[model samples]
Target: MPPGITTFAADAPTLSAANTGFMLICSALVMVMTPALAFFYGGMVRVKSTLNMLMMSFISLGIVTILWVLYGFSLAFGTDIGSFIGWSSDFAGLSGIGVTQLWDGYTIPVYVFAVFQLMFAVLTPALISGALADRVKFTSWALFITLWVTVVYFPVAHWVWGAGGWLYELGVIDFAGGTAVHINAGAAALGVILVIGKRVGFKKDPMRPHSLPLVMLGAGLLWFGWFGFNAGSWLGNDDGVGAVMFVNTQVATAAAMLAWLGYEKLRHGSFTTLGAASGAVAGLVAITPSGGAVSPLGAIAVGAIAGVLCAMAVGLKYRFGYDDSLDVVGVHLVGGVAGSLLVGLFATGGVQSDAKGLFYGGGLEQLGKQAVGVFAVLAYSLVVSAVLALILDKTIGMRVEEDDEVSGIDQVEHAETAYDFSGAGGGLSTRSTPPGPGTSPAPTNKKVDA
Candidate 1:
């Protein structure tokens, strides 16, 4: 067993097996968050490309599933090469991992850990697709994800989580993934958006959601699945993990929901359900990194701060002229940063069995370490993602044909629509005129079957 891992020796075998089983369930729970993400993003886009948006998430599920089996797992968690990346020697090629412990000190099945981590790998890049909705070709995104995961995502995951990783050695506390998952995905999303450029007719267009109910449904699922996400980080069921993460998740989400609504009431003159839903997600993202590290009060602060920052960041695209269609950069990138940095100050001792933050009198050194880690992730993700995006854009093209875009991606890309109410008494004849200048209809009703 790992040196610091303490348990009754007589209970070791049973508890370890139970923890493995629990984590398997947890990993499956986390995977559901991606489809949930599909709904959340699908409901926010123009009617023309709703199915296309969901396809982005679906595409990741297939592509990353394959890649994770091939080398994605090894790259992230395999034996360290140089404190920068992992060697591929442990490439089990789907069989390399099993219900056996690989790390020297850990007790859970190595495969359980690998699969749980793989869900995260699959979803992080998918989370970025919200920024370039309705424009990028499906082929381009597929190729881009292939390359980006290899060059950008895998190495960063190694640097943070893998044994002998630099950040892990530096005593940086991720608990979950403020830097690796949320922040890395967020920064990479920004870089790709910049390279891909804005979606057609953004800001001036009235790109309202086609279905508010879908968004709500997605939010509900995410909330349900997140319990596993935050708690599962422990790799086991224990008092410490249950105590800190449960409370942290609850309070942070609540605080963020309230903050987002409060801000909307002040700015837009009404409290919107959309804002409340969005805020809840914002809170979840912010708390992800710090959930296992902080107190209830600290969780509140993190959620409130992230809520305000993301609410403001969503408007940045309009000012800066990038078309992050569903606010990936605004919510994930900004919220990730808020949570990560706050953990530098608010982390209480004993979440991970060691470590505290500057606010708890651990001094400015820990905070500075966090700043370095954050900047490093942002810079690396930005540079690598930009290069990969440009390469894919040049090779097979990125944007769909102009005609296909204007006609709608569902018809052009998927050959189906979400709603097939055609020929109904209240449907065909009531077909409203297509929207015009300064008016973009909500996303077309099209479910992504994948």
Candidate 2:
């Protein structure tokens, strides 16, 4: 019934209602990723701040959803202006979207496309908060998300996805959001880490993850949700979408997994579940940029390389002393760069006309373009995120009170504890405790008289 459905009715374009329905399901699958992220990051942190960490992911779901509905969709997807960003028309307040309205050439309703894209918008920024974990003020973080989403995320999304945007016009291939999502978030994470300063007792503390099982669960969810992520980019049900993306995802992840375990076995004397999960994610991130463009062989190389690089990068914080907490810089930033660059080198036929990589004799032109795009995003994100972090730090402050952090942010900020094994009354409290409460008991003033 929608306008565009008729365009594909005669030949059953892959972009039919069935494809749209699959994509909608895919969107929901992607939406689950943030909560999965919550669990992933939550388990990686100390138990005391678990809920606060989860709250960060949860808040993104709520805040970014509203922001996208308001104007983000328009900025990212509406008609392009000057090939940088989009110009607003129909999507302000979701103005014209309805069940009868199809989106561009897709058979699904516009609302389906909007919701699927919204999940990506929400998760990208949420990824950065991990770098600033246990340090940021909740209110300030909320404000930062609002601003960063507008400036960094919206424009990048437009450039990559919008019809008239430069990257799209230039024939750069990003099946999903390697440049827009992972690289952008990864760069921003580094900037925030720089501005926020290191967490208290960074090198002095052991700072091991409180629970590994939760981390594994989070990884599983991300893997499942990513099917929607990489595959859904096709926006259709053709064999190209089903076969190419599917095999690329599988082979790349498999190669990355092997690479990670191999590195760990050689270095640490044990292949950890953490390594397995991290490798899988690294592979996923690497494949994301090049999946639609490269051969299965190319994907294996990209993913395996990302796994090794990301694994190496995780140690950079310790060596360089940046204290990126959960290694957002190491995994996302490093892995994203690897993926983006490899795409420039390994892109095969039919993905993009002007932008095949070096392997196919496309020359350095495509590779140069890819490099420019990567650097442009990296520089812009780093500078903007640093400025934002400093402003938030100076205006309202970024770090929690030391005592509150020691006591745990779950109780201090959210008023809820992640665990309730003691069956205590604290679990029943309807209101959250203000940060820096009576926990740890006030130090007695008694002093030894000299």
| lDDT score, candidate 2, position 69 | 94
Best by TM-score: 1
Error of 1 at 143 (Å): 0.9
lDDT of 2 by residue, 71-101 (tens): 9999988877898888567897898776667
RMSD of each: 6.2, 6.8
- Model 1 reaches what TM-score against the true structure? 0.90
Q: What clash pairs does model 1 have?
A: 2-105, 46-442, 46-443, 47-442, 47-443, 47-444, 92-96, 418-445, 418-446
For model 2, the superposed segments whose C-alpha errors exceed 4 Å read: 1-15, 350-355, 424-450
Each model's TM-score, in the order given? 0.90, 0.89
